[model samples]
Target chain A: MTIKTSNAGVTVIKKLFSRHETFVFLAIVIFGLIITVVNPDFLTLENVFDLLKSYALMGTFAVGMLFVLISGGIDISFTAIATITGYVIAVLLLQNGEQLNIVSVFAIAGGVGVLLGIINALIIYYFNIPSIITTIATLNIYYGLLTVISKGKWLYGFPAWFGQYTQMYVFKFTAANGTSYGLSVITAFWFVLMLIAWFVLRYTVLGRSIYAMGGNSASAKRAGFNLLRLNLFVYGFMGLMAGFGSVIQALLVQTVAPNSLVGKELDVVAAVVLGGASLTGGTGSVLGTFLGVVLIAIMGNGLTLMRVPAFWYKVVIGTVILISVGASAYRRKVSARRRTIIEVE
Target chain B: MERKYSEFLVLFFILLGVIGLMWLLNGSTFMSLNNFRSMAFQLPELGILSMAMMIAMLTSGINLSIIATANLAGIIMALILTQTIPPEATGPGGIGLVILAILAGLLVAAAIGLLNGFLIAHLEISPILATLGTMILVSGLALAITKGYVVSGFPPAMRAIGNSTILGLPVPILIFAAGAVILSVILQRTSLGARIYMLGSNPLACFYSGVNNPRVLMSTYLISGLYSGVAAIVMISRFNSAKADYGESYLLLTVLVSVLGGVSAAGGFGRVSGLILGLIILQIISNGLNLMGVNTFLTVALWGMVLIAVMVLQFLLNRYKEKRRSI
Candidate 1:
């Protein structure tokens, strides 16, 4: 009897886990497996590091965006902010003419990001313009401003220290023939940032407030929440992350182009939605977004391995977005109908 | 009394401001007949799209799929005219062929719009999400059909309709005027239009009052789709080529024009006259920028700032009205 009870408990736990996000997580893992099998080199330490480096900056932006989306708002201009701040840093480096330090670049980029975020927060919080429309407008404005400031020039010739900083290894392992593999400092930083973001969203008071506001702003307001202040902080946080993201991006690529991040907002939004954030606001998790990013990256990696046409990727991404959102909507209808039936019963 | 005119007043001021900027930057060139004529011709396609958006807004549903539908229809029309229509009978038979082509486009757009309405109104999907799905599907179909190539070789008469001037005004401008008149009458004088406004303002209340909410919702989307078809015709005529990507740029511009024209984004309130003025304001801004030789990239920034200012002004005006009502 005791053995049977224990086995049943294990089955129950497995069933519960399988019900939510488990399917998606399993899908991602299978995708990774398929890619690795298709190209044995895909599982190499060096290739893994390359993949991590490619996604690090975008992952950071996704972290910040998770906060905004959880609070029932979105920042389409985040990527634009990243590009603009990167350009600013590029300009400063050029003007400094070999005298630039990493600290200076970081400071300029962070400041610009915060400033832009504040502007976005102010308009959205105070004026009551829909976040979607406001962000769309600002996305264009920010990119345009970047173009004007840069005069359509690419920024290159970064200091060797900056490059080394991005590529610095946190840990190294030697295989048989003295070949070494290592995790870069940037990847390590990204992992830590994502973990902290996860903690904040899961455990903090402000984090709870974000969920509360997203779930129902009326109740939150009645409960004495300072919505305007929260709005500012949320947008500002996104901006700061975007700034940091830009710095990492600059370091990784060793160059900045004004149009580098064009049309990237859609990708971030897609990842967020795929992770289960409702566009109607409230009800998502940081872990979900992270998983979302992972899933997208895996899809791209898998498609490339299979040599799928580039255009088909758009079709796939668009289809995924439609299906996920459609499923969510259908689920809501089912639940609502169930509630009505129970009430009638 | 003056408060009732506030929206129009603000729009008029914006128009004057744009005109004054044009004068400051390009003096004589800005006011030249040729430039004005060109602006007139270019305004109609966007104008039609904005009008379509307004109809959707009145029903509290947005059709982001308008551009997609327009693109699909334009491509189909071009393909039929260029590859399918025979050469010898291209004159009178071409007229019949063009009408048939337009009918087919309208049917396709209407079908897509109906699907959108069904999903949004009956199935209880969010309007934005529902329309976005259709936007993707329709645009994909357009791209697939054309393989992303421009279809040209429209007959001369159709080209003439695109290029002809009437009473010193371009044909597109004339079409725009006709559309504005017809739509304004429909919106203000018809019971169906009133029912749409009622449904948009409060659906539950409208239903309780015996309105067929689903029918109203479906018809609004259908009308918007019809307008999209009309816009596609004008677009093909003006450009003399049809491309799947042709309508992509107009999506944002259409929404901007509709919202900035005093059409409430929350729906149930708008005027065709206001939309017409809004289109003109946007066109003048674009044309003025051309004359001033402003960098293309900066145009987005400039427009964003202008939109924000207009939004702020609208917010303040609405607040002022509420304050007065409370007093």
Candidate 2:
């Protein structure tokens, strides 16, 4: 009986390891291990925790991007959305000082994001304009507006309480090498958001419909799905995330450059794509996105450790995008061809 | 056919509107000879870039790498010119080398275009993701080339194209006019242009019709590359320098200009004339705002607002038309 149970356990392990998320998780582990081997300081508790902490806001963006991608569209404008909403919050925080309630900032940022997201949804759904194209235009508009209102000004030296709130670390430790480490409120927020995204995508009717829309829109329509309403919710939710992402980014960085997040749409979108989210949409996961965010943060941290020039990072990102996207596409083609061959046989 | 006429009429009125607004805001100063010359100079580089964007968008594709490609091509040409021309060589020999550099830059740019075409048309990747990758890669390569430094000092002859005026017209504007004419002919008269439109409209149908779709797509981007090569020359001349990041801001602006010109983002439709009008309106708005002491960043926002407004209006019009047809 013991031998039979062990055999069943091995099969269960094999089944679990075959998932895309499993590979991504392993890749993160392998990456960590490899970096730790090369520069042993990399495995230090402080450094590892710091690496995870860095991706807190980006993880937020990826979660949002994953939703948009799963619905068979792209949203490059989210970066712009994040910038504009964050700028509003920052300006309010600076001007209002003692009188401004923190809750109001969150509400305003979220409200602005919802408004912008609805605008995106309305234009995209009403006209069926390509999401990327529409977002491209909106990205410019939003960033342009931010720069105008901010007048190229950067907000710095946030109220210490604001920063300390998110910066509050839940875990703390010190190593023999005298390095200190802790998981912060921001990191907790990232995980909680990821968990919520996973739950929404997994357990909700809206989440499954997002997948159905992406998998096959025409069939989804035939099955009585409302693409327009779904788009509004999906893009609006993305905008809300952007608003939250902005708050997280602003609080963490404590200096809001109106144009800081302008070009980061590519980075956010790339992470989602790297997580196995299809550009063609209808497929992705919350866990996969979290892993993707981790992979990027780790890679960037590792590269910095290796002393690679920061400028070459785009090359690395570009190559990864091409290879990952091409490989997935090629796999799909091969599988389809194989299925056709089987049918003929 | 009526749509074409309506677009032209709308462009004419918008042009008039900008002129009227400029006149009202800045009065006679906006119409000064110097203002016209500066505006003319500013117009060509963007105008040419918009034309380049138009061709790509004609196929419902976006080449986010135009500024990068232009900068790289200009850098290479600058390198060649700087290498071949001795500081003392101010004669016809310097002129000859400049021409050679232009040809080389155009050649390299065309090759880049073909690579973009192959990635999109043959590889079957979404245009956005494919071009996004190439944009980053190519720009990285450009950055690696100069280690992020500017290259400058072209021969007098090369600079003349931008700085000199011919027949009371800026040379850049003349070149732009010539380019516009040539492109209009190529797109309207040539078999290649027709095939591109057909392919853009429906690739599967084109395949059924044996239209050599990939080759058409290749040539489409190749021409866009060649146009970028031309725009690079004008830009380098205007600035008297070339750098990896020059014109970096124009990437999104070109899209704005293209779509605002009524180029269907869905592919299979766009016009050079309409684009020219759109670009002119943007130039006027920019120059006019500069004169009025409005923040330059606000202009960027204005462009965005204009684009969004235009997109929304287009949607409304399409809806109205659909509704009418259903009746």
Candidate 3:
């Protein structure tokens, strides 16, 4: 009877949360606890809000990245895509100056995203190139074109509403000690998008197809999945978010520069991979991703609080990607072994 | 093999065409001997890095840490020259000390490659992630050592590698050509080259055939490390300085040069002659565009476009071949 209950418990854990994710979740908790112990201010409401806001842009695109990775490809070019879309929107807004409405801003970003997304999708899927190689080239092309045309132009002094639009608080409060805390629209957008991602991934045919394709593409195709159409949508949808993400960033920075974010795609990729999205694709969760973002944001904030050299952060993030991805690969092997054992039994 | 030579021919003509276009656009100034000399000087650093990348890619693997490894290696050599050797040292002993430094720097670069090999071959991590990790760690170590400042003032013998020309050809070019020939021999004329090609073609098959897959994998990255060492020595000598961030831009461009040279990113297919032609084509396009007063950024864009064009061309060629085979 004890063995039966233990077997059931194992089954339960396996079904609800895979063993690898359980490890990741524990790592996040332990990391958070360590940060809190090192600096109790880390748990403060204001710091929490601040951390969320800081990683909000990365959080937005990490979801888009989740979509791509789940479909068995990777994109480092989204940063370039975001820059192009954001830079265009910033220039247009600056040129129009207070006359531009918000609707058109989103429309333009989304439209541009869809177009570029199709191009990205076509190159990766239709041309049968490795996604990383294709995206690397496009990243160069997109950023290069922007740099040439703009000559490293910086767009500044966005209309007041632009910043306010993203920062419009969904909730706000002031403590007796005068520490104000609030949830901004950006964080709310991130949360809502997380829930939306969970819903789409868990409930939609599109999500199922993507997951199926990523797991075993040949079998998925045999199962009647349309590789061309599905990948086009996946990449296209990412571009749409890139467009939206650029506007969000423009809102935050208030001064948009063309090449400032060129090399930071590594951070986004790190965050998504840390969030438990396998680089080989077909596994990840909204909750895993949210925790990953939270941990990254806190790690950055906590390290700054500790006054560690800023230069070392790149090294730290790179280590995190390696360790996490390495653990996943190890776990994958272990799980395969476990399957063989179970079959033998 | 025939298709390989065809790519070489095509790239050779493209190089000539780019030079002609530049001459037409900018007249005789673009065709001057000085301009050609500078272009040759510029090609070796990029050419060497691309050679390292081609070697890594030949195994259907990549070492994204090439630039970082080169920079790190360069920093080591710089440190030896600037810190160990006395400023006034310029005799036979000084040359001996410089040679020691070069060997030490090469050793460090090879050590890093060994680590990459261990990660990929032993730890079984993907090459991209494995090298990306090392690239970060190595560059961080570099930054820490130099404190983000440039290390300069090497012995003249060391500087001469970058500055001195040998028999009408630049030393750097000579070095680049030597590295290429050695690699070509390794790839085309040796049992080791056959093993590497077989490993890249199918690691599983190689393992089944008892090819000592891990050792082959280790040697490929080891070769990349050796190449980085050579490139680093050249870079340090040419610029007469070293920094953590030097040659950061060359990272992607090397990949472009290799892929554009008809080296398959999926591995098991590449040629040294093809890569050389690709390097020439890029140099001409870049030098020509510079002569035309084009923005440096636009030239970057042009390289990206060229990569895409090559991809499309390959796709069409594959389709046509498939159709012919089917008929």
Candidate 4:
């Protein structure tokens, strides 16, 4: 009887391990434990909260990237989009001596993002340009235009209410060491956004059409899916996420530097790809993306706790991305070779 | 052949038009010999890098790691030169050490290219992802070694490689010219060249025809790596320093130049002559902008706009040609 129950438990564990998200989750747990073993502070509630707070921006961007990748395109320009909107809005607020209104800020930022994203979609579809090529050009155009207009200026000294809004937390607790810990409002926003993305991707026709388009664009078109509309929605959604993420970044860092956000597009791309999104498109998940972000956060935090060189973080992230993507590609090739096709013809 | 000639003709005229515009805008300043000389010097590093990118794109692949590979190789060479030889030394011994350093750097680049090729071809990883991974990893390695410091103080002879004039032309430009000739010969005259075009145009067809796709791809990246190594040599010599972050902006510029040269992004098409025309056009525009004292950021924006504009033009031309053919 014990053996039978143990066998059932083994099957359950095996089934869970079969999932990519579960594998990433397990890696995160193991990595976290190893870090805790090295530095007990790594597992502390304060540090945990700090990790979530720091990685919230990346997580938000990863969600946005997931939408684009699932729709069978890539957009490296989102970083430029984010910086342009965020910087322009902050500069405008500073010039006009206006207070930060949360609703207005988001509306303006997100609206700008949607506008840019629609332009990207229009240029791409109308010209039949490759998504990567279009985005690369736009990445330069947006970033260059921003720098030219702003003279590469940085913005600080946000309104008092913006600072106060950032300090608000969903919950707070005192740790055993008498240190207070709380997840910030921005982190909570990340969670809410992730949940919304998960719901939209899992249950919406828009999401299904995106997957269908990515899986096979020709088939999706034949099935009556509007490729142009899908392109607009996905790119536009990506812009919205970038806008939200930019706000979150500003909230965390309390500064808007135009140049800081452009080059880090790779990190966001790495996170989403690590989450099992194929560059070729048509495959990704919210859970998997969340776990991917967690894995990176854990590795980054753990390395810092262990006093590893900051540069090593890039090496680790790069290796992790290559290994994960290579493994998946190998698995796909093997599956393709092993599949049995019925000889109906 | 006639169509290809017309394409070149159009690019040549565009180059002349750009030069004419620059002359119209800046006149004597743009027409100055000193300005022309400086532009010639500046063009080679970027020009060589564009060729490297074009070669990879020819195989329907890209080496996003090209800049990173160049930096790492240059870093390695810098380390060797700095460690082995004293600063500003110009003896025969120094020349020998420089040669050793150059070869060693090229070897390092080749190894990186081999690794990228392995990941993309053998492991079947997509070129973008594979090269991106290598790019990050290599750049991190470079940063870890240098700790974000610039490596400088090469022997005078090495510096001369960048600054010296020979036969009334800059040595670097001469190098670029020679490299272009060699590359053109390799692409147009060799079996490897044919295989590259075939592979880029259709990999499965190439494979089924008994060509070794993996080997062809490996060679393609290896050649790309060597070109980047050469570009690094030019860059470091020109600046008299090597840094992990050097030429970050050149990545997009190289892409722009290649596409402007009429290299198909989907691959299987491009020419050295067209690329040279593209380089000349860009060089003139850049030189003109500097002479006019336009904002550098605006120049970058202009490059982006030019890239899009050229792409749009290509699309229209292709559509028009197809319509004519159908009629």
DockQ of each: 0.46, 0.52, 0.58, 0.68
| Residue B128 lDDT (model 3) | 73
Model 1 per-residue lDDT tens digits across residues A296-332: 7767766887776554565566677666666666777
Candidate scoring better on TM-score of 2 and 4: 4
What ranking emerges by TM-score with the best candidate at the front?
4, 3, 2, 1
Worst 10-residue lDDT window, candidate 1 chain A? A15-24
Worst window of 10 by summed lDDT in candidate 3 chain A: A16-25
Best by TM-score: 4
Q: TM-score of the candidate numbered 4?
A: 0.95
lDDT of 4: 0.87
Which pairs in model 2 have colliding backbones? A214-A282
Deviation from native of the Cα of residue B242 in model 1, angstroms: 3.0
* Per-residue error (Å), model 3, residue A249: 0.7
**Chain A TM-score from candidate 1:** 0.90
Question: Tens digit of lDDT per residue, candidate 3, span A40-97?
Answer: 8888888888778768888988888888888888777888888899888888887885
Which is the better candidate, 1 or 3, if ranked by DockQ? 3
Q: Once superposed on the true structure, which residue ranges of model 1 sit more than 4 Å away at CA? A: A1-20, A26-49, A97-104, A171-182, A343-345, B1-6, B9-25, B59-63, B85-93, B133-147, B166-169, B189-192, B203-218, B247-249
State the weakest 10-residue window (summed lDDT) of model 2 chain A.
A324-333
Error of 4 at B148 (Å): 0.8
Candidate 3: clashing pairs of residues: none
Q: Rank by lDDT, highest first.
A: 4, 3, 2, 1
Q: How many clashes would you count in candidate 2?
A: 1
